[model samples]
Target: MHEKNAGQNKGERHLMMQGKLNRGPIEFKSRPAERTGAIMAISTTNVVCVPPTMSICDGVSTMTREGFRRLPITDAGSGQLRGIITVSDIVDFMGGGDRYNLVKNKHQGNFLSAINESLRSIMTEQVMTLRENDDIEDAIDLIVNKRHGGAPIIDDESGVVGMVTEHDLLKALFQGQSLLSVEDVMSGSPRVTNPDCSIAAVAQQMNKYHFRRLPVVSDDVLFGIVTATDIMKYIGSGEVFRKIQSGDVSEVTALPIRSIMTGSLQTTTPEKSINDIAREMVQKRIGAFPVTEDARLIGMITEFDLVRTLASR
Candidate 1:
């Protein structure tokens, strides 16, 4: 055992046999160049939120008015998290078969009333949230793996402050790619949507790949497309996605993917500059531009993919 004393030099006791009591100069190798590039903790303190008591219609309207995709549902008084509501959740409910059947049967009034329900009724009560001081990498991992658009950042009191999103992550890489082109970073082969396919099928595919949207393709022709937003728009009709999640593959459950898929699409070409594409995505608040070749869909360049590529460096 080594004798211990703060005043004693390190290894002094071992060197005592040599009768050298004085301390020698310490030789230190260049301490690994102050390792950097570690991600700092991210916060979500400035995120928009809604009260659970608010009607789904109101919440949805708020999301639209504020250009938000999701909102944290909080207690009115306590300001504590109660649940979360996304455009997707609302669309899932609205696009359900029962709701569509009602609309088809000349019962538009009943369909209208359904959307007036409280956010608490439709909001996901079990929300996955990040603390104000959570490591950004952790948030990125959770968001990417779980396919979340973004998550609420909660304060010490559990109140939402802001969000940490793919947009923020991608912003960090704008400087990293000085001359990379869309073709260089784009996914050469992307999962596409088939018009004849069921919405359920497409949704499952989206879930499987954590895709935000899919390019609609049929007979090697690129048509419109389906986005997570497009799906959310119909959620107020029916909870079709939920049924699809529960393993219901019947036709009634296999709602037409074409019905909800967005008809107008924004596309890019292989020769387009990556910086130009990034600017467009950021300005439009959209994820990617389907990379097309000779007016045919060839690939995609999404924020998720962009971030992944940059982070790898």
Candidate 2:
């Protein structure tokens, strides 16, 4: 994917590397002087991968069942890394972006047939990977600058050995000791969606803004939360298949987000300490928390925000 800009001028290449190809200018933060052990200690070893032959529906099922945001694809016989599929990619395939052509054109508007397509149809062929020799700071710099949430860790001979993500980095940085408060790192007035919004709209917003999750609100009160994973689960778990008879992608995406939103929320306060929030995140296995004030949505404290705090510190 990085090679796509090889023909571009130096200045344009810089923008591409800085993750400005489609989004706004990125604010690169942090070069944690942390040791290499920091990343390896937190990375998920014995990484799970799906074969390229796996159906798209089964691929999503694997991710949902495993609580993973991304899944690596490997050659079934050689075990060599082939590609990767993330929640974002699934959203794009589900009608969020141009990738929906696989359904509209390739499958003749049949959502069911489109989903049954092999992961190869939607998987990212050229994945950005982390070599085993790379250090924690190197991982941070690469992932942040690329605007990727996580990456598969590759070894020269063994192929994929582990996986690391912004969430993992954040957990390693602060463990209930930092003095920074949530307000210091939390992004205020997070982009929100409503329950009545269609899955297509939510997916569009997520793709456009590069948001993995959006708080679902009604008349300024936080009602629930919707995430890319949730949408994937809706399909992977057979809920969407059961709800639609026509098997058209629009028939599924046209449904309100409320159909898949998570109403139960684990919230935080702006005045809360980052360390405490970190502890809560680890305990709850949650990546981001909604910051509320007087029972109203105020802001959001995410793994990236906390990771930024660690970088600045």
Q: Give RMSD to native, each candidate.
A: 19.1, 9.2
Range of the 10 consecutive residues with the lowest summed lDDT in candidate 2: 11-20
Q: How close is candidate 2 to the true structure, as a TM-score?
A: 0.86
TM-score of decoy 1: 0.65
**Model 2 per-residue lDDT tens digits across residues 65-177:** 88899999998988889999999998888777877889989999899999889999889989988877778776778666677899998877547888999878877777435
Per-model clash counts, in order, read 26, 0
Give residue 21's lDDT in candidate 2 (0 to 100).
18
Instruction: Write candidate 1's Cα lDDT for 66-140 as tens digits.
Output: 666788888989989999977566445544333333323443434445555677766788888776656656666
Q: Tally clashes: model 2.
A: 0
**Candidate 2: stretches off by over 4 Å:** 1-33
TM-score of each: 0.65, 0.86
